[model samples]
Target: MAEWVPVFRGEELPPGLMRVVTIGDQRILVANVEGTFYAIGAVCTHTEGYLDEGYIEDRTVVCPIHFSRFSLISGEVVEGPAEEPEPTYPVEVRNGIVYVQR
Candidate 1:
C-alpha cells in the first residue's frame, strides 16, 4: 500500500527549481513548474545521473550527465541516450505543504 508523504513546504521550492528527496528507499526528484509540483525518479535512466542536478526546459528535464531529456509530466523520454521512461509519482499540495505518494 502507498501513502502520501510530506516531502517539503511549498515555499521551499520556487518556480523553475527542483530538489532531490528520499522517501523510504526511493529517491525522488521534485520539480516546481510555475506553481505546480511534479515528482519523478531522481536517477536518469541512461546513466544514473542525478536529475536534481539537471535543468528544466519548458516541461522537460535534461540529465546533467548525458543531457537526456525527460518529460516532467509523463516521465517519458523526450530525447535519447535514455530509452526507458522514469517513474512518476503523484504529487499534491495542501495548505502550503507538498506531498508525494509513495
Candidate 2:
C-alpha cells in the first residue's frame, strides 16, 4: 500500500486555495474546495507548468503556462493544451490534518 503523508492541517488550507507538497521525488498539488481536499500531480502535462502557481476556479485548476485547465477532484483534463490527464492522489482528513497518498 502507498504511504499516506501528512500535507496540511485542515485549517491551513481553506476553501478555494492550494499548496504544493513534495513527497519523495513527486510534487503534488493539494487543493481545497469548500471543505474537501483533493490532490494531483503538480506539473502540467502540456508544458511543464507548475500547477501550484495556477489558480483554482471552483474545483478546476487553470494551468499557468498555457491555461490548460484540470479538474482538481478527478485529475482529468477539463480543458487542454494538455492531452494527458494528471494523476490523482487519494486524500483524507484525520484529526484535523490532511493526508495524501504517496
> Candidate 1 clash total?
0
lDDT of 1 by residue, 39-78 (tens): 9999999999999898999999999999999999999999
Instruction: Give one digit per residue, the lDDT tens place, for model 2 in 1-102.
Output: 799999779999889899999999999999999988999999999999999898999789999989999999889999978999999999999999999998
Best by lDDT: 1
Predicted structure 1, TM vs. truth:
0.98
**CA RMSD per model (angstroms):** 0.5, 0.8
Candidate 1 to native Cα RMSD, angstroms:
0.5
Ten residues in sequence with the least summed lDDT for candidate 1? 51-60
- Residue-pair clashes per prediction, in order, are 0, 0
* Residue 67 error, candidate 1, Å: 0.5
What TM-score fits each model? 0.98, 0.96
Query: In model 2, where do residues sit more than 4 Å from their true spots?
Result: none
